[model samples]
Target: MSGRDFTERDIHMALDGELPGEDRAGYEAWLAANPDMQARRTRYAGDAEALRSAFAGVLDEPVPARLTRAALGEKPVVVERRRPRWWLAAAAALLLAVGGAGGYVAASLGGGSHDDSAQDQLAEEAIAAHVVYAAEKRHAVEVPASDLDHMETWLSNRIGMKLVAPNLSDDGFQLVGGRLLPAGGHRAAMLLYEDAEGNRISLFVTTEPAAHGKGIYAQSGEGPRAVYWLDKGYGCAVVGSLPDNRLSEVAKRAYEQLIAGMIS
Candidate 1:
């Protein structure tokens, strides 16, 4: 065992098979000392394989005319960018190993640059997911709170990070459950919590690679109020139907726990 502390991002890289061989050995040793992490790794490995198998067909499809034309500079066409989003959803729903898990479509649009791309894409998908799932009463989540352990593992595998649902009871929201959603070239894990009054909140998390964001970015749109923050190379957003004050407090608490839980 290396006896070194590994950050959540390190775990993600390991899961995605992006870790250097030396680092991969060390991470495996770390998982040996941590049984929970070992189990998480096993589950994640399966999830990754399943995702690849599910989307294997897309690789065989002929390139779309617009993409081909744009590549050759033959046409000035602005594609809607919605096609790939649904393919992601289709893969998630067809997760045979994790049967009956529904997924939400997430489209990644153009951001400022490579630095801002991941953050902006994650934020837009987070809000879009919250808008879609928060309205569901019967099927609010794919894996309910009862299966939170598995949900965490599933999401970690898909998103290439380790995770725990941050406690929100202190913030007046009880854990409802969470689902793994599609995020363009990435993936997202959405945790849904509900207040006693039935208001729902979502915490969206994914690894924010490349450029780190500044401070928290807060905004409100037609659907939900949201506060997004990047900490320790992870991108997270707190979104809810509550007012700015309530959402801000919730975001603060989530941020603290997220920071505290960073592997190193």
Candidate 2:
């Protein structure tokens, strides 16, 4: 098949070794001649690596008998039994990966359950918000970066949490500005950052308490995917319509910068 006819899923499957042998060879050849596709594959590979680093431990840890039974499509007698060691280990792992020590500690102490569906919904909302605002010509942000100090304080106060714009220049994206958005009962801070090509990614943050019952989840739709985690008493959803790998890279960088700012 011609390169023009190949779908993104075909390319992703080929990179993931999920394609049939005959189709794999065709895609490999196509990728070899197509630099853009090759680049996308490289980015996806990096994202896969980052995700494995972040969550593979959870898979290897002996799932609690209850969790294992649930995964096997069996009903557990009691799903609410406390497993402090397992919870602590999971929180510690997440803290190491995201540098949200305070957030993790709060979550652990609160005995709350993390909700996967809620996190997914947050990501979807973030993407919808991106699509709505990225197309704006003059009113993308309520407060532009020109008034950086005021913008930061205004958003922090509005969200009831400190807000800082993560520097994304090393990744070819810079802060454009930000706006305040209402998300359910809590306020959401949407920081808009842009690359040289004018492509934009948004970081959606709110002070909603971490849902402790559900585990971390990664999902993608359209051109963007959301990477979400609970950090320091806040729920963070980093959303972008970029390739999966690029979005993960941006999230990783943003996590590091935001955590550093929070601690320092």
Candidate 3:
């Protein structure tokens, strides 16, 4: 099959190793020829690996006696071979059942860390996106800022929230462009900006809520600093290599505009 014959679904299936054997080679060649798609596939693979890593302990632990009894229910259950995604979903559900409400309650009750894993995942994704795309000079974003309207519409539709690239001219950064990204289990929109000095910042947005105790939190100690915040419609993290103060300024501007967009 020609490159044009491969649809978005086919690419994802290929990434998941679910594509038919006959069509896999053609899609593989297509992905090899397309750097952007190849990058996307890499991101998806990374996400899958991260998921596996997060629950690695579960694989070693024996199933709880009560859970086994509840599932068996006096009848033998035959386990069927399933896709990796299905296994990941099943593992996640099992984990929640084992850990309970993402360990918040268990942690609180046990006097352990009360950090929100979902918000941490969001920040991790945002930083990862920035590290991968911000360094690119030619293909930083899938859509250029010159086509702002289309970029806005496409990302908004895919991410399930009306998205507008926040104005940051006051902070000396201009919109460079934006792109769609796989953010764990959520579809994410990333808006890239550049300053006169050639420094870049990316605002990663997702419809999934990422609120924790801190309304807006700044991540410290890393290659890049990130400021994450939650909105009624979506959550966003502004990531850049700039100083903490500078990054916070950019994040504040983005937060105001995003909140205003939701209000109006």
Query: What TM-score does candidate 1 get on C-alpha atoms?
Result: 0.55
Alpha carbon lDDT at 23, candidate 1: 73
Question: What are the clash counts of all predictions, listed in order?
Answer: 1, 10, 0
Which pairs clash (backbone N, Cα, C closer than 3 Å) in model 2? 103-232, 112-212, 113-211, 113-212, 113-213, 114-211, 114-212, 114-213, 114-214, 224-241
lDDT of 1: 0.68
**Which portions of model 3 show Cα errors greater than 4 Å?**
1-115, 213-222, 231-233
| Model 1 clashing residue pairs (backbone) | 12-160
Model 3 agreement with the true structure over 43-159: per-residue lDDT tens digits:
888998999899999989987554675676753232232223443343333334434322321222132132355555677789899999999999999999999999999998999
| lDDT (tens digit, per residue) of candidate 2 on 113-164 | 5554455556556767777887786999999988889998999899887777
10 residues in a row with least lDDT, candidate 3: 104-113
lDDT of 1 by residue, 214-233 (tens): 22222332467556755455
| Global CA lDDT computed for model 2 | 0.68
All models: lDDT? 0.68, 0.68, 0.71
List candidate 2 segments past 4 Å from native. 1-113, 212-221
User: Looking at model 2, how many pairs of residues clash?
Assistant: 10
Model 2: which ten-residue window has the lowest total lDDT? 212-221
**lDDT comparing candidate 3 with the true structure:** 0.71
- Candidate 3: the clashing residue pairs are none
Q: Residue 4 of candidate 3: its Cα lDDT?
A: 50
